[model samples]
Each structure stands twice: as C-alpha cells, then as structure tokens.
Target: MARRGKKKGRPVSGWLVFDKPVGMGSTEAVSKIKWLFKADKAGHAGTLDPLASGMLPIALGEATKTVPYVMDGAKIYRFTIAWGEARSTDDLEGHVTATSDRRPSEADIRALLPDYTGLIMQVPPQFSAVKIAGERAYDIAREGEIVDIPAREVEIGRLDLLDCPDENSAVFEIECGKGTYVRSLARDMGRDLGCHGHIAVLRRVEVDPFVADDLVTLEALEAAAAEARPQGEPGEDGRIVDTRPDKERFAALDALVVDTGAALDCLPEVAVSDDAAQRIRLGNPVIIRGRDAPVEASEAYATARGRLVAIGAVEAGMFKPKRVFTGR
Candidate 1:
C-alpha cells in the first residue's frame, strides 16, 4: 500500500467573524483567511456579495459543521435604496433596466412597508444565484438572457425607514429571515412607490450570536500575522520551520477565533455527562438527565465538561447525535 501524503495546513478550528469590506468576495475572503491561518479546512456560513460589506461568519475545520445553524438564524441588514432607476441585477452593479423621474416620500415608503412585513412572496433579482435548469440566474443574465425566477415565500420580520439621505436615496434597516434578498426589497419597494429603485449600499449588521462588532478586519488579520514573532528556532538550514498557530506564534490571530459552539448558541443546549459525551462522540444515543432538560426538542446540541460533544435532537429524554464534534 502507498503511504498517504500529510495534510498541508494545521488542524485549526473556530469561527472567525470577519468584517468583510466591500469589493472583496466572500470566497476570496475565506481563501485569504485559510492561507493566513494555515487552516486544514475552512468554509463560510453565509455568502456576502463583493458589493456588500458586513459581518461574514467563517468556519474553520470542524466549525464548518455548524454553519447551517448560523445560516438559518435571523439577519439584520442596513441598506440604502437608490430611487429613480431600477437595475438589471437590482443593485448598483447592474445596468439600468428602467428609469423614473419620481422619488418616494418617507411616508409613501413606510406605507408600503406594512405590505412587505410578515411572510410574503418575493422574486429574486435576475442577476442572482438562483438556479435555472442547473445554470445560475446571474450566469444567464450575463449572457443577455432574462429568465423568470420563481417567487418564493420569505419572512421579513421588520422594515423601518432609518433616514432619507436625499430624494434619490432612502436608508432602511430590515430584519429578515433566511434567503431574504435585499436587492429584491429595493427593487420591489421602488416599483411599488412609483419610482425605480436599486441597492446603493448594503451592510449586514447582525446574524444570530454574531454582530458586526465581533468582526476582525482582513487587514488586522494580515497585520497580526506579519507582527507575530517566530516561536521556533532556526534549523541547520537557518530557516524557521515551526509555524504552527499557537498562542506563542500567532496569539493575536488565534485570540480572534470564536469557538465553534458559539455558532450553535441559537440552538438549545442539552447538558450531558462525560460518560454520555463519550457515547455521543461514538455516535450513540444517551439518556439526558436534568429537570430542566426538555422532553423533546426539534434541534439541539450536547455539551459535556463545558465542551461540545455533538449536535442532535432531544427526544424521549435521549440525546441522539446528528453531527459529532471532535474539538471544542
């Protein structure tokens, strides 16, 4: 048998709350972090457009398993809708599809808000990630083809007018559930208010258990990596080789990591014994004890000795592992 090759990067795991700047794609940001941290595996919980800037939760190593939880959480976005013109992509990134000399009054915009609130059917923009016959909508749109993207239900918890920066732009803050498209909101609002609209600026401020304040900028991460003193001595070749990410080498970088369990904070936690944790880690169900323990929970996580064991459900006083965790 042939010997397997060693993995390229360190087995680092945690959520890096990145404050992604506009013009940097989410995939590029994740790739940058993976390189700077030298992590073995990395993924982001949500995708932020290059034109959008805000809290982007990135998962490294085992933390990737918890991404779905973060994705399903409610998100808050502060967006500025530029009235008088609708774009092909429904944002400033696309070509102008329609134009209107009329702009909406604050009262008119707020009056339309009531209709958008709660659950409503929404059509994603033509330039979007939605798949059409296995092809992305945006890809087709780039080829000068407009496909009819189906309308689906999305929950808008609240929509508030923050300010009218000017007659051409209106700033709004929206609290929405998963899959809500801010660009669509801008487009729809513009149409309903008798003025064409598109997104001028979009900033995501919150995802459950994460806020913009928790974010570490990419520049800061790079600067920390540059400033980190090499903790290893030079080899016979006079080159430092021990570049593992530990407190001694990249303490500043490592300190920015949020635990994987933190992403599951929105889910109810089921406390289990060390013995139960061991069983859970082995993919076995164990009896969950505690008067406070829920008799049943659709989705929850198990913790033992203050460390994450697995993500699963509590049923009939038992914890059944769905996704197991190997690290804290």
Candidate 2:
C-alpha cells in the first residue's frame, strides 16, 4: 500500500464568526479566511447572499466537521423592506418588476405579522440557489426565464416589527428555522398589503449558539494579520523573510478562532476517559460509564481531555462513533 501525500497548510481548527460585509459572497469570505489562517481546509456553515451582511460562520480544518450543526440551527435576521416597488431578485440589486403607491400603515404591518409567524409556505425568490432540473434557479432566472418555484414549508419562530423609519420602509427582526428566506417574507408581506416590495437591507445577527459578540469584522482580521506578520524584508523571490518568533505569529491569528467544539455546544456532550476516547477514536463504540450519561440520544459528541473525539449516536450505555475528528 502506498502512503497518501500530506495536504497543505496548517491544521488550524475553530470557527471564526465573521461579520460578512454587504457585497461580499460567502464563498469569497471562506477563501479569504482560509488564506488568512493558512489552513488545510475551510468551509462556512451557511451561505449569505452577496447583498446580505452579518454573521457568516467560517470553519477552518477540523471545525468543518461541525458545520452541519450550525447550519441546522435557527437564524435571526434584521432586515428592512422597501414598500412600493417589487424587484426581480427580491433585493436592491434586482430590477423593478412592478410598482405601486400603496404603503402599509403600522397597524397593517402589525396585523400581517401573525401570518408570517410560525409555519408558513414560502416560495423562494427567482434569483436564488434553489435547484430546478439540475440547474440553479438563479441561472434560469438570469436567462430571462420565468420558472414556477413551488412553495415549501418554512418555520419562523418569531417575527417582530422593529421600526417603521418612514412611510416607504419598515424594519423587522425575525428568528426563523433553517431554510426560511427573509426576502420571501418581505415580498409576500408587500403582496399581502397591496404594495409591491423588496429587501432594502438584510443582516443576520445570530445562528443558534453563536451571536453578535462572536463576530469579527474583516478590517479587524486584517489588523490581527498585520500584528501577526513578522517584521521582515522581501527576499529575492519576493517572499517575506521573517524576523519574528513562531509563538508570536501563531498566537495573534489563533486568537481570532473560537473553539471548534463551540459549534457543537447545542448537542448533548459526554465527557469520556482517555482509554475509552482512544477506542472511540478508532471507530469502536465504548460503554458510557457515568450514571448521568445520556442513555439515548440521536446525536451527541464525545470529548476527552478537552478535545473532541467523536460525534455519534448514544444508545443504551454505548456511544457509537460515527464521525471521528483528527485535529490535524
């Protein structure tokens, strides 16, 4: 058997809750974070539209394994809907498709809030990532095609009218489950009140266990990178010739990361002994010894010596290893 070649970059692991500025795509943010950390791998928990700003959690290296948990978690968004003109993409970037002089009163908007709350059927915007016949819905919409997008059930846990800045627009804060589209909510609300509408602004403030305090802006990240970079002159090859200690360089960048296990905080955790952890690491189920250990859980994580070992199903007295994490 031949040995597999090692992957590139440092084994940096953790979640970097990013304040993704408007106009930057989610993929671009992930790429930039990977380059900044010089990590072997990186990924984001959820995709934020290019026009949307706020918490887009980027996971580096081993933290990528926990992204699904964050993605499945509830999201809180603060957005403003401009009432009067309906747009093609359901946001400011789109072309105006329809127009009306009608603007909903505060009473009208408040009355409509109940309709948006709880489980509701939503048809995603035309310019969205939803797939149609193996092609992206946005692609089809771009070709000047009007495709019928079916409505799907989405749960909005809480919806509130935050402010009505003027007669033209109103701000709202919504806490919704996975797959809820704020753009759709805006569009539907406008339609209901007889005023065409589109998203004027959008920002995600929270994703379950993560929140505003967890966020780090791109400007701050660049500043930390500068502080971490060794004082050096460019070599003949144009690469930096370092004049800083290894520890100093690592500490600056590593400080930006929240623990990889932080993303799994919502899940039940079972702290295990080293011997049992080693067995769990090797794809074997281990008997969970403590009386307080959950007897049955569909999804749980096992940690040993403060590091994550495996995420698995706990049945009876056993913790069955499903996906194991190697920090490297």
Candidate 1 has an lDDT of 0.89
lDDT of 1 by residue, 148-243 (tens): 899999999999999997899989899999999999999898888989899999999998889776889888898888856465799999988767
The whole-model lDDT of each prediction reads: 0.89, 0.91
Best by TM-score: 2
Model 2 scores a C-alpha lDDT of: 0.91
When summed lDDT is taken over every stretch of 10 residues in candidate 2, the lowest stretch is 241-250
Clashes of 2: 0
Please, what are the lDDT tens digits per residue for candidate 2 over residues 156-268?
99999999999999999999999988998889999999998999999999998897999999998998887766567888988886766655776777898998899898889
- Assess candidate 1 and give its TM-score to the true structure: 0.93
| Per-prediction TM-score to the true structure, in the order listed | 0.93, 0.95
CA lDDT, candidate 2, residue 170:
97
Cα RMSD for candidates in order: 2.1, 2.4
* Segments of candidate 2 deviating more than 4 angstroms: 1-7, 233-238, 243-247
